[model samples]
Target: MSYMKEFTKGLVKENPTLVSLLGMCPTLAITITVQNALGMGAAATFVLLCSNIAISLLKKIIPSQVRLPAYIVIIAGFVTFVGMILQAFLPDIYDALGIYLPLITVNCIILGRAEMFASKNGVGASALDGLGMGLGFTLAMLAVSSVREIIGNGSWFGIKLAPDFIQPMTIFIMPAGGFFVLGCVIALVNRISDRNAPVRTGCAACPNKDGCAGCGTDSDVKEAK
Candidate 1:
């Protein structure tokens, strides 16, 4: 695939949060405000970019049997770097993000790409994939946080949107609000994509690209038969 395709797929086609539904923890937690979303998004993106590049560069050297552990160590290093940077310069965001910031080390989106794309692709391609996926994740955060912040707090990015005469729905800013807003956003995305299909737990449409374990293909089924 072209470099542009590598980058563009993450934006909407296989958005980590929206389409793939990878990182729901941060998606629902820190997105109560746009500022928090921006911070988390930027931090996670930086980690993803750095980790993907490192993994791609070391792919040839990493033994196949130990690639997963090696990838985790690489990803953890970047995540720690990002956390320290945030704690030193952006203390407020760092505090607000709290443990969730460190939890990015285990974010499914980052690990999924490391395994499915970066490990197999060239450095340039892996970097683009990381950038694309990061942006897609950020966009999803912004979308959910913006809606919640506005309706829940009557504010956008901490600026009051509704006049003092109108009261905001407190529930929108709470955990319940996150779920409601996320569901709406997902539905909207599905509608725009012309797919109103029912949700399924199966990995039939997973974007793992290379292949996902336990999601046997026709060949595997035939072999068993």
Candidate 2:
């Protein structure tokens, strides 16, 4: 495939959070507010871009047996770098991100891109994929967090939307709200994306209901729903 096609796949086709549904932990954990969501997204993007580039550049030199570990180290190094940068430059974000920043090391989005795309693709293509996926993830997180914050807190970036008697949901500003918003956004996006296009549902590899996991094997899977 052309480089553009390779890159675009990560944006909408294989969007890390929206389509693939990977990296739910950070997505749900940091999306309580728009700022937190944006911070986590940017940090993940930086890590994803750097790791994909490094993995693509050294894919051939690294033995297949140790590729996974090598990728983890590369990803972890970038995450740590972002952590320090945030701490020094954006102390507020750094403090808010907290332990979640370290969690970026294990974010499936980074590892999945490195193993599935970066390892076999060219550096340019890998970089593009990383950027696309990073941006997509960021968009998803922003979408969910924005809705939550607007309704749950009656504010967007600290500006109140509902004036008087606007008692916020309150829950939308908490951890549980994150999951609720995430699931709702995913479902909403899926519906919109599938409306005009022929869509398939169900997870072929899963033992439970279809679309339970992030895998896209649902295309050929048979389902009752």
Candidate 3:
């Protein structure tokens, strides 16, 4: 695939949060406010970019048996770096994010890309994939947060937007609200993209299909027969 395709696919075609449904924990938790969303997005993006490049470069050197552990260690290092930077310069956001910030180390989006794309692609392509996925994740957070904050708190990024007569719907900022908004957004995205519910057809659609052995393919069944 072209470099452009690598960078652009994550924006919508394969959005980690919206389309693929990765990283729901942080997405739902930190999206109560736009500032939290921005901070989390930026921190996650930085970690994703750095880890993807590092993983891609070291993929050949790292043993396959231990590659998952190695990827976690690398991702954790960057997550730690991000935590320190946030604590030092943006203490408010750091505190607001709480444990969710550090939990980026285990974010499925980062690890999934590391395994599925970074470990198999060149550094340049991996970097672009990371960036695109990061942006996609960020944009998804922003979208969810904007709706929640606006409707829930009658504010956008802490600025009040609703008229005096309007009452903010507190539920939109609650855990239940987060799920509702996320489901609505995902549905909207699918509608806009003309996509139906995904169908399971063995491993053909999986990125790791080539190496995964948990499921047998038609060819494998034929061969066995």
The lDDT values for all models are: 0.90, 0.83, 0.91
- Candidate 3 residue 86 Cα shift, in angstroms, is 1.5
Q: Ten-residue segment with the worst summed lDDT in candidate 3?
A: 202-211
lDDT: worst 10-residue window of model 2: 204-213
Tens-digit lDDT string for candidate 1 (43-118): 8999999999999999999998999999999999999998899889989989988998999999989999999889
Residue 104, candidate 2: how far off, in angstroms? 0.7
Ranking by lDDT: 3, 1, 2
Q: Considering lDDT, which of the candidate structures 1 and 3 is the better prediction for this target?
A: 3
Better of 2 and 3 by TM-score: 3
Q: What is the per-residue lDDT of model 3 for residues 11-86, given as tens digits with 9 covering 90 to 100?
A: 9988989987999999999999999999999989899999999999999999999999999999999999989998
Q: Model 2 misses residue 172 by how many Å?
A: 1.3
Local accuracy of candidate 2 as per-residue lDDT tens digits, 1-84: 787776676666667887777898888787778888898889999999999999999999999889889999999999989998
Q: Candidate 2 has which clashing residue pairs, if any?
A: 203-210
